[model samples]
Target chain A: EAGVTQSPRYAVLQEGQAVSFWCDPISGHDTLYWYQQPRDQGPQLLVYFRDEAVIDNSQLPSDRFSAVRPKGTNSTLKIQSAKQGDTATYLCASSPGLGYSQNTLYFGAGTRLSVL
Target chain B: AQSVTQPDARVTVSEGASLQLRCKYSSSVTPYLFWYVQYPRQGLQLLLKYYSGDPVVQGVNGFEAEFSKSNSSFHLRKASVHWSDSAVYFCAVRNSGGSNAKLTFGKGTKLSVKS
Candidate 1:
């Protein structure tokens, strides 16, 4: 079984530039999440969706970041105006369900973004 | 709100020696706990998880963790360490209640195995 897939394993951009990261989750998974991991830090939740409906996005930087899962299988996270603080690895994860036992998330290798 | 703490930022252990990495969590209620390992340039992989029942849980790659409610700690352990076991380990927690509880992660502990 193939795991979660993400594209553009690395990205380098200048300040104020815009970029988008895509994710394809495992088949049959209903929960998809986007996380930002700064160097030497743990993954922080940016947004999440369950079957095309956003479940939570309170932590997302609304002004510059946006995410969508239109068909409920694939997702895209975008940064409108990147900043130096946006330099971090963007990780995509998915789970089978929302229940306790099915909450284990499988992650992608992540897209390492660098804003100069 | 839930949070996870990994006291040790780095740990060095000789091969074939026992190992232990500590984790602590803060939550209003008992939360689902997890341990994940991330290799260089790789995504995080599940090592083990504890939801309920036994305080000790076994995971992949000969890894195990003990959950102590009184101590509010979940520490990963291995009877014998291998060089391949070197990686950054993250401890996570998820609230049991509510429908949209997200997982909270620790800063992570980097383990180095000396041969």
Candidate 2:
């Protein structure tokens, strides 16, 4: 019963640099989501996928942010030309299904990103 | 659109004291509600959830939440608090009917237990 796993527990970069965060969801989970949590704030959804197909990404910054779940088991969220505003914790979560009662999300420790 | 609100930014309570955290939601229809707790340097963990039926639902660690449709609120409560219960509590909501339902979270309430 392994929980969701994320890589690079922390990251620091200068402005204009690029970085990517990876996530490995729990086995058999079909829904994967990426969220951004600013300091002292709740998580904001960035993008989500269900079985390799993106379900929603309206909040994603099209110019710099991108995400993909090629094989449906793992996902990667990238930020190009990072800025100071991008300094936040990048969280990854997954759920078993889309059912109203069963979609409880399980989250990872999150990658704390700092852009100077 | 759906949203959640946590009125209290922080709360302090003595050990063994009763606790209550306030939450309110705005949505066109009845939404699925949830409460999650986040410990230091840890991810969010589900405390409890309410989709329908009973207005009160029990969660892990002796936590419970009551849903009030008239007030559009779901408040977390505990009969007795413990020092270990100190953490940031977040209230969330998601539309009951949707294909790609996303949980909208509140700013969160930070609870401190004083021994």
Candidate 1 residue A32 C-alpha distance from true site, Å: 0.2
- Candidate 2, CAPRI quality class derived from DockQ: high
lDDT of 2 by residue, B1-115 (tens): 9999999999999999999999999988888999999998889999999999999999999999999999999999999999999999999999887675688999999999999
Supply DockQ values for each candidate: 0.83, 0.82
**RMSD to true structure for each model, in Å:** 0.9, 0.9
Candidate 1: segments with Cα more than 4 A from true spot: none
Model 1 interface DockQ: 0.83
Please provide, for model 1 over B2-92, each residue's C-alpha lDDT reduced to its tens digit, 9 standing for 90 to 100: 9999999999999999999999999888889999999999999999999999999999999999999899899999999999999999999
lDDT of 2 by residue, A36-109 (tens): 99988999999999889999999999999999999999999999999999999999999988455346999999
TM-score, one value per model: 0.98, 0.98
Q: Report the lDDT tens digits of candidate 1 across residue range A9-61.
A: 99999999999999999999999999999998999999999999999999999
